[model samples]
Target: MSGYLTTHILDTARGLPAEGINIALFKIENGERQKIAETVTNSDGRTNAPILPAEAFEVGQYELVFFCGEYLENHGLTGGNLKFLDDIPIRFGMDDPAAHYHVPLLLSPYGYSTYRGS
Candidate 1:
């Protein structure tokens, strides 16, 4: 099987899939953010497929931008005017391109968590 980069989003406050949330994957190059791909969470709060294929994975810094504000408002978890957080961005690194990277997000209107997943 080929290696890949994958992600999932879960709304801890509501205990459901964070559907419809927009997510972006970016690479940090020369102190600038270069977008690699963009995807919106499906009904299950996951990408349709792996975000990065083995051929695309590289050893470098990366970022995942989660559209938390819009997601909360759309799901009635928060009002549209809420400002606790807008687009929350998580930055991490891929030290080994040959391995799979599963980045899962556990999110709430007020906070979020992420870690290297299987």
Candidate 2:
């Protein structure tokens, strides 16, 4: 099997899947960034498909930017003008071309956490 990337978001404070969050995937090479994929999380807090499909997978550094501010605001979970958390970007490297990369975000209005998931 070849490598691919998947992700999801859970609203920890709400104890539910974070629906309708926007996410972007970018490949970083030579100190520059190039967008590879963009999708909105579904009702299950997951993209419809792999952000980086195996056919387009490559071994390198990548970033997943989660647009959390709008989601938080839409759900009435944010402050008036200043958001403690907005767009969250997670950067990491993919070294194996045949492994699955599952990165998930646990989010709240003021903070977030991520880890490599299976």
Which parts of model 2 are misplaced by more than 4 Å? Answer: none
Pairs that clash in candidate 1: none
TM-score of 1: 0.91
Give lDDT tens digits, candidate 1, residues 28-111.
987899999998999999999888877777888899998788777776766456567779899988887578999999988778
lDDT tens readout by residue for model 2, 28-79: 9999999989999999999999999999999999999999999999888896
Candidate 1, poorest ten consecutive residues by summed lDDT? 74-83
Best by TM-score: 2
Candidate 2 clashes between residue pairs 3 or more apart in a chain or in different chains? none
Candidate 1 regions with alpha-carbon error over 4 angstroms? none
Candidate 2, TM-score vs. the true structure?
Answer: 0.97
TM-score of each: 0.91, 0.97
